[model samples]
Target: MYLNQHEIKSLLNKSFDNFVDFVNTLPDIRFTASPYGKWSAGQQLDHLTKSIRPISSALGFPKVTLRYFGISQRPSRSFDQLVTDYQRVLNGGFKTTRAYMPGVIYPSQRPALLQNFLLQKNKLTVKLLGWSEKDLDKYRLPHPLLGKITVREMLYYIAHHNEHHLAKLKDQELQGYTWQNQLQQLIF
Candidate 1:
């Protein structure tokens, strides 16, 4: 669906708010814990950080690649690793591009890795708001996994991804509480 700037901004704001709420609900320790064997909290945050990079780039000025991650082989790097690597690079004023081709790796990480995920998310939201409809369409990018996604699709995926993770985190929280209650009754 094609979203006007206002609609995109609203969705981005809401999505970011939901992500913040989800993060707040977690215990500090859980920030380092992997909800599943596959991904840690830090990794998830890192993923979010990297996810916004393309949007940020698109919003900054006119570019060939819009609404999608750049046309690079770096898809092999998980968003988490890229965040960690990029965080360091960003700190030093040195930007690094992905070294490999797209679709080569499964991205994963712990939450502690991305301290500014929410902030970056907000920046991206603002960026989306400034985009013209034509720019959004012109920069239609393809996802290695999803394939040929428009800018609107990319925005939807951002919110959808956050929601998917939030649900997983909530499930983990509920399961922990249930387990704790069961253990308490047994101990008592």
Candidate 2:
């Protein structure tokens, strides 16, 4: 339900670790593979990196300055509530905006991609930890799709957002996978 900073950080760290593990399972060639006109697995990873790094900087902005941007803070939402709301947004066809898109070119090296993902996640976790408990429920930022949410909800969203992308990646490949085949291929 309500997420304290330690619980939030632990959730993010676990989610990131799970994601990196998933990334390692994909064949190197699949990194660049995509349906006719879509982002490759590599590009999806880069897109996530692009999306989260800016939030780290956004967190650094003084509260008064953020308020000046006209994004008013809302009451903090529960973690479970955010997960449910996020799923609705996903099913509602919320798309990543053009500005958040990664460049067409992507790193071919799997290790490099993993490293980059881990680094950005670490940066985000550090930023999240730097906040006081009151700040978590006080400060707010404009989420591209969801608009203004408190810092706690934003962290909750970040954990779920990464899971969403990985699900999308799996969906793109599920066309060819039987349940057993998928189990054999997906290492968890």
Candidate 3:
């Protein structure tokens, strides 16, 4: 779906805010624990900050410079389609590149990382508001995993990506939810 600037802004704020709130409620140990050897919540937040920083910075570039990445000739994918495409890639075992990885986000780094995440998110929103609805569809950005996607699609991904990580964090809680419960649900 083609999201207008207003819709984009609202989704962006909602996703980031929800993630931050959830993280804030975590005790320091839980925040930094790597459940089932997956990334800790702190690492996930750091990764999100790293991923979003580039998009926010790129959006500040002049339109002409932004077009250096090339403009899209086709329509932007609906938000749902983009999310599905991302899921498909993930299911295909397309791992994140080192560039976007967060090595070791210590508990002490949590505040800085969260602050940076908010900064990037706010900058992206402001930059997006500066754009015309037409330009959003006209411009393209290079997505590391999805190749070139329209600006609007990038924004859609940003909104969903935040939620994606939150879900991963929640999934950790289910690790010890008990085999009996898992089997009962499957049997039912």
Candidate 4:
């Protein structure tokens, strides 16, 4: 589906709101528990937070380092590291949370994490509202697994990724399976 600025912004806002609502309903125990064996609630939050860092950085302002290094040649970095770096940048005033991903760090101080996640999501919605069609077309960064992709593509993938996780989270909630229990079932 093609999206103009207004449409994109609307989608972003709605998605952000939906995410906040979902998180708000989650009990603290669930937030800390891993739905699956591989990732804790905290780790998933870290992963989502990491995923958006490059996209926001690429789109919000051009980085001379990126230009100089080129997309393909940029240093290999772990997603977790990038997320942490983005957080640091936010704290330092180099970037705002508004441009970051829309999820809270799992197992964090619940109130603050939720507050920050919602705040950042709102900021990102505003940023999306300001984007031009041309901006969407611009290549943001290279994915470690998928190679180069545009801002629009990244946005689509981000939504899909969130949906995938949300589905899993829902399953965990409905089944009432803890991380260890899920692992035990898989082993059997």
Q: Per-residue CA lDDT of candidate 2, range 1-188, in tens? A: 99898998898898878778877777754566554467767888888877787777787777677665454346688998988987888689987898788665444666777788898888888777678888778777778878778878888988888887888777766753556535544642
All candidates: TM-score: 0.62, 0.83, 0.91, 0.63
Task: Give candidate 2's whole-model lDDT.
Answer: 0.76
- Model 1 is weakest, by summed lDDT over 10 consecutive residues, at 99-108
RMSD values for the candidates in order, in angstroms, are 11.5, 4.8, 5.4, 10.5
Clashes counted in candidate 4 amount to 0
Q: Note the Cα lDDT for every prediction shown.
A: 0.55, 0.76, 0.87, 0.54
lDDT, candidate 3, 55-109, per-residue tens: 9988888999988889889988999999999999999989889999888767798
TM-score winner among the candidates? 3
Better of 3 and 4 by TM-score: 3
Write down the worst ten-residue block by lDDT for model 4.
Answer: 71-80
Q: What is the lDDT of residue 116 in candidate 2?
A: 82
Best by lDDT: 3
- Candidate 3 is scored at a TM of 0.91
**RMSD, model 3, all Cα superposed?**
5.4
